[model samples]
Target: MRNYWVRIALGALVIFTVGMVARALINRGIGGVRGVVEGSGPLSIPLAFIPFRLGGDKLGTLERVTFERTAPQSVSSVRLEVKLSDSLLARGLEGCRLAANLDSKDGHRRLSESTFWCAPAGSDTALVEYGQAVFRPGEVSVPLYLPQDLIDELQDLNFDGDSTPISEAEIDSLEASTELSVDSAPVLRARMGDSLRAEGMRRADSAKGVPSRMADSTRSR
Candidate 1:
């Protein structure tokens, strides 16, 4: 009886250890998602982890931002390019949104821009283009754009044009320093029907005991 109990305890310990290790691996694999936004100024906004779920039925996170030039020194139209990480694109993109950050009042911000859903990536890459009007002196508001959890990260963005725009040489140097590809591809957007269908399929698969592929698709080296 004593030997049998010892064997059972050992087996339980082994199972517990294996479970913890697998959980750790899953967490590390399902890492944060990111994207880069360029133009509107010399500097750019790099948004990440804007309220995404991990290790669940949810597959990915969506980030939408609008770049606006303030009045007195505004361009007719600013060329904005957003490059998404393969991880975010692989799990699938919900949409792109142009949000304005209006002058905040009543201790809250408001969104005046529109929202757009992007198409799923059928290949390794995709692109889209869009145009937005500039408002001088008045602010464009994008209140609920960023993931609420990661909203604090926006404080680091240098929207003020006081700083010199990145020089061509600097841009070239930075591009050379990184292996990441920066494309002028059209912005990626998915249709609302596609999004709903995808979500329904994911839910059905979940109920059928199928594991989510988000972590497998999003794991970055």
Candidate 2:
């Protein structure tokens, strides 16, 4: 009886350990989801998440809108880019730009406002000729310049009462407005969508002939 009880206890311990490990792996995978913004309109400009390679083949994504301090108390200006689906070009949605309205954490004040212009790789201007020649079919990353003064102000707002110095801060709750032309009036306005991971997983499941939960529920109704 003693030997049997020992074996049962050992089996239970093994199962518990396996469950904990599996839960941790699942949470880690979920937390790795990248942030993305998808456009909505007749000329639907789906913002795709293309893996950016950095420092010799290391792959990553634009997970957040972060502001970094260059010195102890001074911040440097930084530029961020967002990738648009290549279908935009074929669908005659070229010369488009995204105007983002970043609000403060309290949602009472606007932190910074900037526009993302189609800046081709290795080019400074967002001219039609330059942008078309460089980014044709795959995707194009448009750049949004954030000034140093804006970063400094944000740091002051996002700071917590801690001993650790604030080196970086992330801006949340961005409202993106799509303009048909650079510096023109916005044609359509929309908020950023669900996580890139959720979108990718749905696509993968669809490709594998798995019916979506929504579709199944609809059929039952």
Candidate 1 per-residue lDDT, tens place, 98-214, comes to 322222323223211221222233321222222432111122221123222223323233323333443435323323322121122123345532454465456456745633465
Error of 1 at 13 (Å): 46
lDDT of 2 by residue, 14-131 (tens): 2211122222223334342211101111111112232222211212222223223443222232333333333333122233332223334342333222323323444533222211
Query: Model 2: what TM-score?
Result: 0.25
How do all models score by TM-score? 0.21, 0.25
- What is candidate 1's local distance difference test score? 0.28
Worst 10 residues of 1 by lDDT: 134-143
Q: What is the C-alpha lDDT of each candidate?
A: 0.28, 0.28
Residue runs of model 1 more than 4 Å from their true location after superposition: 1-43, 52-107, 110-221
- Determine the C-alpha RMSD for candidate 2 after optimal superposition of all C-alphas: 22.0
Q: Which candidate is the best by TM-score?
A: 2
- Cα RMSD for candidates in order: 23.7, 22.0
